[model samples]
Target chain A: MSSSSAAPGRGDGAEKPPMRDALVAAAFRLFLERGYEQTTVDDVVALAGVGRRSFFRCFPSEDDAVFPDHERCLADMTAFLAAGADDEPVRRVCAAARPVLRMHAENPAFSVRRYRLTESVPGLRAYESSVVRRYERAPAGYLRARFAGPRDGALRADVIAAAVVAAHHNALRSWLRSDGKGDAEAAVDHALGQVRAAFGAGPVAAAGKGPEDVVVVVSRRGAPLWRVVQELETALGRG
Target chain B: MSSSSAAPGRGDGAEKPPMRDALVAAAFRLFLERGYEQTTVDDVVALAGVGRRSFFRCFPSEDDAVFPDHERCLADMTAFLAAGADDEPVRRVCAAARPVLRMHAENPAFSVRRYRLTESVPGLRAYESSVVRRYERAPAGYLRARFAGPRDGALRADVIAAAVVAAHHNALRSWLRSDGKGDAEAAVDHALGQVRAAFGAGPVAAAGKGPEDVVVVVSRRGAPLWRVVQELETALGRG
Candidate 1:
């Protein structure tokens, strides 16, 4: 994962392709040395040996370069989810979340620095959050497609997506907090396991079985009496 | 739920003083009338009869005022979670989420207008993202505290919190998309119910039981397994 070289000029600097990676490396170096607030676009440009126009052409804003290639990763993840053959699309969606971990693993140092910066800076924090919203929506949409029925499967899909993201986020956040030195991929898997455990431990396969088995038991007891009956029926049906 | 009165703000008028609700009303009205981008802090100040400095004083930025008293609400929720006697804090945390829905319900029009503005304006959208981050963190922290045992309960708590917020956001976004008309509280309740069903439906009282009877399992099904197992073992143990 660490061996993959940073791609230059995917978004900006079409004429001078190398300027994009150069700017990223330059920006991270400068950010570390001068601190994020003190470092300007001019500093990054000067260090990267690129003109101001070239820098802006590569990255619309200074903050944009700090994070890894989220746009590309998101597209890849979307394609992966779309390409699933399994009828259990939620599992496929969960499987697709692995790429996000792989992405962070590709550049652990950059990921760590980006984590530190987002935590300290509000604008970057907002940018990071917007990216997370996008990440969450992909799986949510996929789950919705998978779980679609007459019921509020939209809500179910959204929660499943949320739990998946939540798991990923917890993994990522804890790993970042550990300065990316920890096993982020394992953390993500652990997080997703929680998602699976939360939504899994019962008759969800019946999701495709139709909305007839899907009862909304509102009482927050250990489990509603009806859910117990439903599970017994599901187990008996399986037997 | 809709009848809950707005609380008095801190005397500084910056930290949500007495006239906070009035300012929110004035700001939303101006946003609707003149358009959100065209409307200025000055316009909000003029309509609310507060000084320009006071508007800035109340909200560090104009975008901040679009939200209800989140700081106060977060604090209220934190207190609620801390004080809960439920051994399983996840249930208590889910219960605590209702205050957020109640806050929106109390001022449906204001929430609706804010939602419209945020959807249209990039700046407000950024601000909204930051607010959602806060929403995710509170339960994440509470869940972390309760489930920080040797097992991966910490990750479970974090994911549960994330799912809870995702459900809340999904419901809130749907209501906002619908222009805040009709059963937003119901939508939110449905969303929260999904969270409770996923995470909180487990056997909460199993903490006191012996490990052999606890029977921790993870399945790909969507039913509440922990409770089902608890009930099964309880039945089988007696048999």
Candidate 2:
């Protein structure tokens, strides 16, 4: 909708546009045409019909322009995780990833273009990695606080948090690599399902030995009896 | 050993000292004394008694000096993983992390100091995240290639790779935060053990069902029998 309003560089006769939108549109256009490195802050402002002060007000630097919405998305994710229930921490974290997925899905062309650009640029790749880590930390920090215990709870929190982020990225990247075609929601859900299957035991199984105990192991139906017994023992922490 | 020969800036008599080492020493000294931002490349060259050419030859930038050995360690890890047998991808990846732990362990004082410095500097933290992501990619790429099959193998590979890195960082950070005191090897091993338990099933268990199957589930001793049955069914993929 914003793109149709006025051409990026061409100052179409209209009321003064939103500076942030104009700057972002101009920056992305310049980046795609001349490459990220070749495009400068002045180029962005010149195209947007703005000055250096306006550009700096919108973005800290040229690199920040490439990822204009990360701060907003990160804040939303942190707030989502903060509002999660004490129970089902893993599920809550998984749910928190939805907004991110939606943000990309809402703008498929931009997401795909950004993904390709990031893949080609080392600095952008590094900056993207930091952004990804911040997202990971939000969930991991939440889980760490919720699962604060002397046992392996802290480790579990970190592992599950990393796993969730990995799965989300896996699904999202696959969709992006496909140029944003196909059912991204289903792809994300399927990926999340695998995470749940792998780590969805929740606090119940993690508590490991209430007053009573039950041990179940899954292996090949035709597995040798001894192997089954050994697996059971291993699962029970005996072997 | 290098530290004992001469004070970093004093330049004690020694024929043709290693320019790389000298630059690093000078840079760290200045960084400590004046803070990372306050120190300049000229200051480092002046203290090291080296030219700008020599400093640039040794380090691409000031940040690169802070992580002098990452390239060598990364190469070592890649070679270790490359030599791995096809059947034990998880174990091989786990083994690949050992050298990194050893790198930190070999220089406790330097590692602790670098940890403190990185903790205080946002630039360094972002740089470190990028470094950590590189390490994560090596193992994840290995697993993705090895687990190149259906049934969430890619997802599993990515998740496990992330989990291993997270566990390693958790253990390493705890040790560094303690000023590198205590048994870091044992701590890393324990952390890796949790990763193995949580995600060690590898591609074999990940294959789902074979000709036959056995399902095992463990619950608290006092858990209801029905809950045990339900968990067993879920583990068996029936529920």
Candidate 3:
């Protein structure tokens, strides 16, 4: 849960660098030079100029440091969603995803390196997958807040959030595999577009509508003719 | 990969069942009778009437025996999606999800028991999350196939897939948490409906050949006046 916090040690007047981030940097460097299996916490702490106690305070385990602080990201995303304006709930989620996208963009080198390591290492990859899924849930939580019932609400949120995160991974993996050769931002945008498109093209029109005229749908290109007719039928109870 | 063989014993059938199923059943019963932490692999195997080697053969670890056989389910889903008629890609994916739904519904008792243990045990909950995310990937994989591309293919597929799975899990977790008290099928249908609605009420409308022609959206119910007007405007793009 503490991983959702954005900046480590933010409350104090003193601006101490995050021990977690330093350890991660050291670990990544060591992983690249000495290989992931060979590297140890003792080695990382020595390189980061941090004590084992400080390292332990920041992360519960050595492997935990290899990932981003998702707990903080989740909390920040929650706050971003909670603070969203009353209108355009889906858009608000997309906006929240932007920060996460930017976080990767800002640290492309480190991200690419981490991606390489995670890809090559199965244990790290699984751990990374688990961590990323937690981030995916943040947007899901937001969607749940704006939807009707838990069944659809939770699903809708999870789908929306998962899409965004999946897009990021696709882009990140592509970029990493290319050694950062590709347009990462473009990749992120492309991925976010899918999420936006799915939600935009979806039946959410009814979600925000009144009971008197309860059918909700926005006309979009590429939809089949009869399917539209079916929705119309379902909404009106007759074709 | 041997997990996909379906045939119970081919020497490669680690986690394949009758044996696997029995072990899971025994584990759940023991977890209920005692507690998850108190239960061991030996207890589960002994109850299932299998030796220690056989238990390990069916499950990689004690914790894994408790989870839904996602590898088998994922493979089944992938094969189902691959086998779908070209004309009904979405329907095929929907059909694929049915087995997953059925797998849960088939043994509501086991599913319920596993859910209880997972909820109570933090480690089990984490493992449960891992399995859920893996299930989400199947739909994502299907979506990727539906829109495989030189451009916009991956993004479109991944996001749609993510959303679809999110919807599925949302429905599933709700049912699981409720002790199988809720309508599981309805929950799945509602979640799928959200996917349909998100993708648009139906397939995208076809383009008109003539500039002067009015593109009328005839629905089961009459198309909303606003949507009709919008369609008309779209037909005659304001050049």
Candidate 4:
């Protein structure tokens, strides 16, 4: 999101940046001064001192102006996931989610303001959900490719992907609600740690199962080996 | 959903059901014959042999007509989750999600048709996401209450809720994509079992962590409990 002020690489250096940033600045100013629904593309362009064609060239819709860098973040995340062929699937996917948080954290005050702005508008809220749904697809697609053979491969991918996104989002939301102060990375790391603990695979697959077959336990971190064994037994109702 | 044909208990069955059902039926017929954007509230009422007042009384907007039962389904799920005080958090939330699937399963042909309709219209797709977001809050809220003591309590609730919803939707989407032909319950059951395995807590607390704290491991099902512990030790790099 840091480079959102710079155009989407349609052009580079000194030509497109000012107009793009001006339009974004103008849109938020007007949106804050006179509510989101009350503002229009024409009003934004008028404030930005640009023509209507320029506005359309930069943003497909008014909502796009509200969330400028999602496309870049999504592409970066997709590329990152694509490059990780040998890593653990759950861990790789959780790491893949980091760039998204970085996008929001790159400009904390703007992200915080946008969070409040999105909360206030129904259209923007739905638009935000659709954007998030798009983010979830990249890691899910990656995991699906990795777990392609199991009958439940798609199901596992979907659930783990959702867990990673939810955990990251839960952490991000808390940080934003606190006015985007403190260490966003730490909050997200702690939250993503929960996902890893809950969904991560072992160094070796379960001993007697098929290579793709598995059983999982939701256990505590840092516990001694024997107690974790007891917890697994209790979870399976075998103790 | 079967009873979406009935009023929202706004009134009894003597007169409201036929008119309410007629509005929905007429709206869908017109939406299919003419495109959703091409059709209007006036056309729906006119086709139903009713006035605009009758239409608005039954549904607040055209989108609501497309997904008429979500409100009822959401209410049913919230009540179901609210009553599960003594159950394990993840398992209870998974059960709470069943009502939503049952709503779709209750009327499979209509669900398949509606899924197609939703796919074709971006506006309706966003609207549907908002509705699904509403359903997620019920279990998340319930789990949040059940897990209020720990610092990561809210985070656990959010991630577990997302996992449950994603698994259920994955199952439901496959069933709907199959033209709603098979046993939806069995499909949903299989998918949600993945959630139970991935996120479900042990029967007892971990030996060293707080009773409210937890750690979880995702592994294979039906494996020996000792194998699950081994997987955990391996995941934690203690092996």
Which candidate should be chosen as best, given DockQ against the real structure?
2
- A18, model 4: CA deviation in Å? 1.8
For the predicted complex of model 1, DockQ is 0.27
| lDDT digits (tens) for residues B130-218 of candidate 3 | 67667767766776776676476666566556666766777888898888877898888777755655452333334563323334443
Highest-scoring model, lDDT: 4
- B1-239 per-residue lDDT for model 4 (tens digits): 24433323221123437777788888888888899989999998998899999889888899999888787778878888878899877778888888788778767767888899999998888888777777778888998999899778899899988889999999999999999888999999878866765556423433454654555687555543434654665565443
lDDT of 3 by residue, A159-236 (tens): 667767777777666777787676777776666655554453322344445434544444344444324434543554
> Per-residue lDDT for A127-182 in model 4, tens only?
88888778788999999999899778898898889889999999999999999899
lDDT of each: 0.68, 0.75, 0.63, 0.77
Between which residue pairs do clashes occur in model 1?
A12-A57, A12-A58, A200-B221, A202-B223, A203-B223, A204-B222, B9-B16, B9-B17
Query: For residues B1-239, what per-residue lDDT tens digits would candidate 2 score against the true structure?
Result: 25732222211233434787777778777787789989889998999898998888877888888887777678988998988856467767887899898878877888888899899988889999999999999999999888888567788799889999999999999999999999999999888866654555322332446745555456664443333434543464432
Residue A123 in candidate 4, Cα distance off native in Å: 1.8
Chain B alone: TM-score in each candidate? 0.71, 0.78, 0.71, 0.79
Who is ahead in TM-score, 1 or 4? 4
- 3 versus 4: better DockQ goes to: 4
State the TM-score for model 2.
0.81
For each of the candidates, what fraction of the native contacts does it recover? 0.43, 0.65, 0.31, 0.55
DockQ of each: 0.27, 0.38, 0.22, 0.35
lDDT of 1: 0.68
lDDT score at residue B224, model 4, on the 0-100 scale: 36
